[model samples]
Target: MNLVESEYQMGKSKIFMRESQKQKLDTQLHQTILSRIIVIQRWYRTIHQRRHFLNFRAMVVKIQAKHTAMSI
Candidate 1:
């Protein structure tokens, strides 16, 4: 009976340790994913800004061209 009790305790300890390790791993994974999302969002914002700038520049050029034609 004593040996059986000791074995059970050891098994329980192992299970607890495994669960703790898994929780830590999950937390780390969540943080890494969050960081990646932030980086992607920043990159997307930069691309959007660049596109907007290009569109604004194009409009300015078109407006200038129209003015020149009117002057001629």
Candidate 2:
């Protein structure tokens, strides 16, 4: 039989398939979820690192200003 004819059945609001088909779909779903999670994590890390760098730069500038004022 063809894949469409043998692999699944359609009900009013759901499609039913064999265990192997379910496993295949589950694996694909997990992979997609993991990839999205990685993207989100990378974005969060970039924002966090950028904020930390800006804070450090501001502190350095403040210290330099104080040192220059004291020397003058």
Candidate 3:
């Protein structure tokens, strides 16, 4: 059997998961894997969005602090 490895990067970090296949996958198994993949994708998106939002909020706070200092 042929074996292969792949890499996927999320944000600035790297993650790896090994997957093996020696024969055809049944529908139930395939469905389970697909659902898990979907869930992981959603989770990653949520994390990335939160990071962006926090960065934006921090920038706003910084700007407000600077403005207040200038006024004083």
* Candidate 2 Cα misplacement greater than 4 A, ranges: 1-5
lDDT by residue for model 1 (1-72), tens: 112332233453464334555566678889999999999999999999999999999999999999999999
In candidate 1 the C-alpha lDDT for residue 46 amounts to: 100
The true-versus-predicted C-alpha distance at residue 41 of model 2, in Å, is 0.6
User: Which segments of model 3 are wrong by more than 4 Å?
Assistant: 1-25
Q: Estimate each model's TM-score.
A: 0.67, 0.86, 0.62
lDDT per residue for candidate 2 within 1-72, as digits (tens), equals: 233557788899998999877777888889999999999999999999999999999999999999999999
* Model 2 lDDT-worst window of ten: 1-10
RMSD of 3: 14.8
Winning candidate number (lDDT): 2
Give candidate 2's TM-score: 0.86
Best by TM-score: 2
Candidate 3, 9-34: lDDT as tens digits = 23556544343332223445788899
Worst 10 residues of 1 by lDDT: 1-10
**Better model by lDDT: candidate 1 vs candidate 3:** 1
